[model samples]
Target: MINQVSILGNLATAPRQEVLPSGTVKVSFLLAYNSYYTDRSGQQQEKAEFFWVETFGRSAVNAGKFLVQGQQVAVAGQLSGGNIRLENGSYRNCTAIRAEQIEYLSKPQSRTADPDVEPAVANVEF
Candidate 1:
């Protein structure tokens, strides 16, 4: 079976970054999308969905450096999930997207004067 997913949404939260014990960089954020439908009464209705997304390596670094809350992005990846043991000695199942690629759909409103900071590029894939 093929396992792939592609979504376009706005970032619901700022990307959070962490360094693993093995020295790999990890970044995670929430993506939100809206669905519009017409009800039986002919009234328009909208529903929002949020999903957790994870990125690693260069993509993680770029996401941490450039992505901000409410930024639009497109992600292509696969679904990943596992059970985690909580501090309360209970196990909980979690699901997330393991991003293989991320495309920035919107550019930042402003740029820093720091020359070290790279300029934001449209449709950048990482």
Candidate 2:
């Protein structure tokens, strides 16, 4: 079965990065998407939806360093659903994306480093 999903959205929050005990890296972030529709009364309506996205390994490292809140990003990944327990002890189904590839659609100008300085890529390990 095919389980791939792609989304282009703005970052709702900053990316959080962590390294596990096994030395694996992880990054998590929230993405916001907007939908526009025409109502029956001929009025335009807009709705926003948020999704959780996770990346691992080298992708996680890049995401952590380059992504920030309000930046536009394009992500291709697999969607999965899980059950979350609420504070009232009720179970709720939640969906998230396990990002396999990510692209920066829009980013702040300051995010770029000085052209005179070379990026250190030799030290980065996958």
Candidate 3:
């Protein structure tokens, strides 16, 4: 079964970056999406959903530096279910996107320099 999801929205906050001892980098943020629909009474109803998004490795570091609060973004990835225990001792099932490919939705007027790194080479076998 395929469990992929694609979304276009604005970032609720800036991406948070962290590096682990294992050399893995992590980036996390929340994306807010909104929709409007007409009701039976001819009234319009608006709803918004916030999705937790995460990226790892090189992509994670890039996201942190380039993405800022209120910036629009497009993301393609999988939907995952995780849980967090609340202070009330209730478990809340968290829904999030494990980002596969992330794209900027609008033109970036300013560009930030990426951390310098050696060019990487890869080999593929057919």
Candidate 4:
């Protein structure tokens, strides 16, 4: 069965990086998307949904470098299902995306480069 999904959304949090005991890198983050729908009354409404995204290897490394909280990104990957056990002794079904590819759509407007940091581009034309 094909288990692929693609989504374009805003990052809900900063990408967290971790190094496993075996020396592999893992990066994880949440992506939030807004869905618009019309009710029977014909009024438009918006609803927000969040997804967990995980990436490894070069994809993880690059995601950590270029992605930040609130940035717009497009992710393509497969959905994997698991379970989360709460402290209350209840198990919650969980689903997450194992991202194979990521694309940066836009950056946060409030982000600015520091004077000490070099510009990403030496020259550019609009």
Candidate 5:
């Protein structure tokens, strides 16, 4: 079964990055998705949801460098289902996703974006 998801949201906080023992990079961020509409009273109403998103490998590393709190971004990934093991010998089945491609929705600050990043997306298979 395919478990892909695409979302466009604003980063609630800075992307936290770390390097694993195996040399793979990890990046995490909080994204807030919102919806708006006119209510019965003719007032605009907005609803929002916050999600904790993460990525692995080079993409994860780039996310940490290019993304910041409040920046808008778009991402596509596969949802993951796993369990969180507690110190009390309990487990909590949790939900998350691994990103495949992430794009910043905001305009570039200058002619040069993040120099560390490739100008275009790479065609590498995971």
Candidate 6:
């Protein structure tokens, strides 16, 4: 079965990076998607949904370096589910998108105004 999934959303939190015991790089972030609908009373309603996204290897490194909170991005990947251990020592089931491709929909806010510095790449896929 095809497990492809794609989403365009804003980053809710800055990407977090970690190195696994096996020495692989991992990055994760929360994405927020907004939707609008017409209510029965003819009023417009807006709703937002959040998703957890994860990337590995080269993509993970790029995401950690270039992505920032509130930045718009498009992600293409597959849904993955696993259990995560909580601080209380209990494990909870979680679902996340395993990103294979990420495209920056909007330019990241520059941290410096130096004209000599290079800009972040707009699209990354691995």
Best by TM-score: 4
lDDT of 5 at 45: 92
Top-lDDT candidate index: 6
Residues 1-109, model 2: lDDT tens digits: 9999999988876787999998989998777888999999999999877677889999999999999777889999999875434456676565789999999887633
lDDT of 3 by residue, 1-126 (tens): 999999998776567788879989988777777889999999999987777788888778779878876678999999997653445666655578989889977632333444443222111110
Error of 4 at 14 (Å): 0.8
Give every collision pair in model 4: none
Against the reference, the lDDT scores of all candidates come to 0.78, 0.78, 0.74, 0.77, 0.71, 0.79
Q: Which stretches of candidate 1 lie over 4 Å from their true place?
A: 82-95, 108-126
Task: Please write out the lDDT profile of model 1 over residues 57-85, one tens digit for every residue.
Answer: 99999999999977889999999874434
* lDDT at residue 111 of model 3 (Cα atoms): 33
lDDT of 3: 0.74
* Candidate 1 RMSD computed on C-alpha atoms after optimal superposition onto the true structure: 9.0
C-alpha-based local distance difference test score of model 1? 0.78
Clashes of each: 0, 0, 0, 0, 0, 0
**C-alpha-based local distance difference test score of model 6:** 0.79
Q: Is candidate 5 or candidate 6 better by lDDT?
A: 6
Candidate 5: minimum summed lDDT over ten consecutive residues — where?
A: 117-126
Q: Write the per-residue lDDT of candidate 6 for residues 1-126, one digit (tens) a residue.
A: 999999998886678899989998999877778799999999999987666799999999999999987789999999988554455667666567999999988955566756565432312121
- Cα lDDT of model 5 by residue, 6-87, tens digit: 8888776567798889999999766677889999999999987555678999899789778876678998998776553445
Candidate 2, residue 50: how far the Cα is off, in Å:
0.8
List the lowest-lDDT window of 10 residues for candidate 6. 117-126
| Candidate 4: stretches off by over 4 Å | 82-94, 111-126
